[model samples]
Target: MAHVGVVGPSSADQRELDDAESLGQGLAQRGHVVVCGGLGGVMAAVSRGAAQSGGVVVGLLPGTDRSAANPHVTVTIPTGLGELRNALLVRSCDVVVSVGGSWGTLSEVALAVRTGVPVVALRGWPLPGDPAMHAVDSVGEALRTVDALVRTDD
Candidate 1:
């Protein structure tokens, strides 16, 4: 199973949240591990979806308080590294999936792309055409792209 990191804004809109939730559930049902910032908005929705579907969720929190993590998180790591934890999150995953765009999400995508980790962007930021970065429109496309990348990497 792939360790898939799901990145997005903590203050996402309804559409993003819905997509993130569905993405999480799909990733879980497909036997992939879900990783996230473990706060709110997209993170919380994704975590909830994944947890409800019997998937494991690793939450790398920016703060030192485990309680700050969303309740759906299966394992909480309070790194206290602030935004720098984004690097750790990206590095820990086999593939990074962006449900929406934010400064933090952009940072994760940049790190993953720069470090040779595959990235599947779902309605995310426009990149400069990196081969490792895939832009997708729907949750199904994102899952398919992630599966292809992980299989190719293996």
Candidate 2:
């Protein structure tokens, strides 16, 4: 299965969290693994959505304590690197999905683009002026872009 990293605000409004959850559910339903920062807000919501869909969710946590991880996370990797853990999250995925705007999310998008990894932005995320950066308005379009970038063998 393709591994899609979801980057967004850890503390977001309800609407943003809802959007992230929807995108996560869509990705999981399509048989993709969801990865996130494993904190709260968008990350927790996305993990919850993906797990509810019976998909594997990996969380690259920023702190040493895995207890801080959300309940939806299936696998927790405690980096203890704080924001520097963002690079691991970006590199570990086949495609990156940005749900809401935040500095951390923006860093992931930039790193993904710089590393030649495909990125699908849902509800408008900053692009790095790269052709691999896809700005999709809906979750469906984001899913389509992800599928196109990371083809499934089965």
Candidate 3:
């Protein structure tokens, strides 16, 4: 199964969380694994959705303490790398999906694109001028984009 990383605001609004959850559920239903930062807001919501759909959810945490991770995370990877942990999150996934993100999420998207991983931006986010990157308006479209760009051999 493909691993899809979700990057978004930790303190996003309800709509953003809803979008994240939708995307997570879509990915999970398609048998794709979900990966995230594992805090509250978007990350927590996505983990919840993925777990509920019987999909494995992995959290690439920023610190050593597993207490900060969401309960839905099936695997908690404590990097202790703080913000630099973003690189790990992006690299661990076969496809990257950004849902109503902030600066940190933007950074993750940038890194994923630079590393040649397929990236799908939900809603609207500034990209690093890569033609391989895709921008979609909804969760369904995001999932479709991910499925299309996924490199199975990798």
Candidate 4:
């Protein structure tokens, strides 16, 4: 029922990829939309999962060509802003779920926190200054947290 951003490294290990895929599937099966960077790594995995589950996927790409987007993306938006497109991805989400670590993913998390959009992280930035951004254990917990956070009027 919500558009969730899935952010993480463009190159990650197999476990992270699996986790991200599961998260995407879970979100999709629950009728939520998946949004991501639209390239490779976690982005591709999540997109694939969502697509396989018959869920919609929106990829905010960083280049001028939609060809760079993952094949599973239902909708691709090429921003031509490169990394700066990270801001757009965060801003467009109802909530963000970060799968693994990277400067890019951290930036997305920081933007989401600053902009009042809640983040359900898996294995990303370790923000000691922001304990509130710490990750929960599983994909289900992440989605549950996101649902709980977004449902609040605050």
Q: Best candidate per TM-score, number? A: 1
For model 1, residues 108-154, the per-residue Cα lDDT tens digits are 89999999989999999787999988999998898899889888987
Question: TM-score of predicted model 3?
Answer: 0.93
Which 10-residue window in model 2 sums to the lowest lDDT? 123-132
Q: Which window of 10 residues has the lowest lDDT sum in candidate 3?
A: 145-154
- Lowest lDDT sum, 10 consecutive residues, model 1, at 145-154
The lDDT-based order of candidates, best leading, equals 1, 2, 4, 3
Clashing residue pairs found in predicted model 1: none
**Model 1 residue 120 lDDT?**
92
Query: Which candidate number would show the highest lDDT if scored against the true structure?
Result: 1
Clash pairs, candidate 2, are none
Give candidate 1 regions above 4 Å deviation. Answer: none
RMSD of each: 0.8, 1.7, 1.5, 1.7
Report the lDDT tens digits of candidate 4 across residue range 118-150: 788886667755534648877778878877866
User: Whole-model lDDT, candidate 4?
Assistant: 0.87
Candidate 3 lDDT score relative to the true structure: 0.86
1-154 per-residue lDDT for model 2 (tens digits): 7889998888898877888888889889988989999999899999999998998999999999999999999999989999899998998989999986877788888888889888888875555567878898877787888888887423
Error of 1 at 18 (Å): 0.5
Judged by whole-model lDDT over C-alpha atoms, candidate 1 comes out at 0.92
